[model samples]
Target: MSDIPQERRVVTAIPGPKSQELQQRRVAAVAAGVGSTLPVFTARVDRGIIEDVDGNRLIDFGSGIAVTSVGASAEAVVRRASAQLQDFTHTCFMVTPYEGYVAVAEALAELTPGDHAKKSALFNSGAEAVENAVKIARAYTKRTAVVVFDHGYHGRTNLTMGMTAKNMPYKHGFGPFAPEVYRVPVAYGYRWPTGAENAGPEAAAQAIDTITKQVGAENVAAIVIEPVLGEGGFIEPAKGFLPEIVKFANDNGIVFVADEIQSGFCRTGQWFACEDEGIVPDLITTAKGIAGGLPLAAVTGRAEIMDAAHAGGLGGTYGGNPVACAGALGAIETMKELDLNAKAKEIEATMKARLTAMQEKFAVIGDIRGRGAMIAIELVKDPATKEPHPEAAAALAKACHAEGVLVLTCGTYGNVLRFLPPLVIGQDLLNEGLDVIENAFAAL
Candidate 1:
């Protein structure tokens, strides 16, 4: 359909002939420190499968870290982007505003959950969107401190890194982090506080109390959170936990900002993860899948809060690239046409059934969590003991890759396997990918 080829494989080994040669060249020319998730360099990809340079075909469960939700190489996306390219490429929006940029902002205002008069600002990446959100929050609330939770990942930028929780990889040697960025415990049910039964509002409340008591809520600009924690683990925060935090922020005049970079664009069954709880945040940061893989991110919020920033205070050199905006328009249309929200629920059904079955048989699977297609499996040394088994998780992922599936490992301890398949993936392909994972874990 539309030019995206149906599933087909032409190569043998994953890094077959051409890919290996290129890999050697890449090793010599490119940075060796950059890690490759899949050994094979991609020649082409569509829907759920990646065709390596060597012609080997592998099912893609990573979805480019949840960027291409509709699918890899979506036809409509390609066409719309190509059409826009023919007309014009870049004359930065700040230099010369265009309808495409305004159109995308309009779309975001309408799409993002809120009835209040909302405004939007575009950026080039998730990190940029996050940074801008923080800037706006500080300006709006006139406070210095920003509160983030444990296991939360905002981005890799300096300020975002400070807001991010993990240490080894994201923060390791990069900091000296930003000041006034506060860290609090998330409602992680699996590793609940001493006797806290199930991660609930009380767990979140405890964290809030500690933050307010230590940092003083009056000094806090925003309480930033990922409705469903992404890199930390695909752990959905406990029920009522988010609402409690949102209320606390409102009561204290703290800006409630939802970092929906990984959890937005129907990846979490709703248009946004925050929708599940009916929580209306003051500001929401979005990126990744917003433009069907192109680099575009945004901050959408109430008009007054966003306007608090001076006219020149917020913007980027390439904030709303024309091509990216076109791609976003196409992506938005594709999501609506395909009813991706419904597709997400279908994905959850498939994932829960498969993962639940695997958990029933494998004692290593300590937890099966997430919403919609944004699912993950937390591995353990012993299910009863609940000690994280990072090595086992790495081994299982390696096994799955060899068996023709591409998955990713995340979480603070690197013991969780996250699945972020394109929403357009065929059921058969999804099942086949899950089978690879099952076989990998079962064999272990």
Candidate 2:
């Protein structure tokens, strides 16, 4: 790994020469469906900075969408993964079992919520874990229907696409989605029909009623939701909502699956975001930050529920690649040794304070919501109307990029500016990134 400085510098235009060349090549070779966020290619990365091919150093505020909470080049991850590589790359855990895979499963069983006997199955992406969780739920309950909330993003796989709410970019034209998937209202405090205070109880009631009367909860296998809505604008569903849903699931024998892919692994100031609500999900899907930038994911839940699937029912060829497992163990070690959870809480405090102040100054900032390092601000055209201002978000992100700050925009309406700085990010760099964002709003 390159020893990148913890400074932001722009030596050339945002994309520069090499990135422009690569972008041109990517336009031809890469699939049209795959989109690039900034078109500026990264060459090297430090804790909180990404150095582009043009030698421009940019303050990283996205952390590859919360994947590198321990940093892209974290020392333990590099060391452990490299050692595993030298030993043997892959024998396929199915064909030849390995200790690393079992170790990772054990770590997940210990780390995830709930003390009850638990088991875990590993995969290569969040989508795969989610798909497997649904499979386990269906097998366990002998039911087919799977319920998901509005603005909930599970993954891009076929079944996951059916579970996801968004249409355009994700589900558009990819028709003939999987069947027996249902959608319900989320307790989005900002957009609930009633006030924020009523959102929790009301949305839960509406969801429970719909599941009971419309779909018949007995037919439902699982209810999947994000503790903090990720692609849907970082909407932290109103308080009391999750616990209510969990209760309903328990009452009806439906599996409650918390999709904590973006909010888990200490990104949300806790081991998992569900900890905030003190809700224990029957099954939990996790990825992104689990493996220190490695492609790994897992579906962990009650042992009986997880074991419902028949032997050789839930697995893939590269599900628990030895190197990725090593990376996960190291990542877990890094989290405990560094106390990244506390760091996440500290980051949340610093960021909420800064963003809240910005909200006061900027009328366009309609909401500032998120816990820990996974923070975001929603932009609206009018505070009263709350109309999405995607253009403003786009412009603001462009401004930050020009100033050598890497930021990202997301939301159902594309009006949310989310921040997921690495937990190990220096306070100075994070504050500097915030300073750039402040200037961008002023320029906007």
| Clash pairs detected, candidate 2 | none
lDDT of 2 by residue, 1-444 (tens): 557889989999999999999999999999998987889898999899999999999999999999999999999999999999999989999899999999999999999998999999999999999999999999999999999999999999999999989897999999899999999988999978679999999999999999899999889999999999999989999999999999999999999999999999999989999999898999999999999999999999999999999999989999989999999999999999999999998998898898888999999999999999999999999999999999999999999989998888889999999999999999999899999999999888
Local error of candidate 1 at 53, Å? 0.7
Candidate 1 positional error at 329, Å:
0.7
Residue 178 in model 2: lDDT: 98
TM-score per candidate, in order?
0.97, 0.99
* Cα RMSD, each candidate: 1.5, 0.8
* Best of the candidates, TM-score: 2
lDDT tens readout by residue for model 1, 186-222: 8888878553356777678788888879999889999
lDDT of 1 at 68: 95
The deviation in Å at residue 433 for candidate 1 is: 1.0
The lDDT per prediction is 0.88, 0.93
Stretches of candidate 1 above 4 Å error? 1-11, 194-197
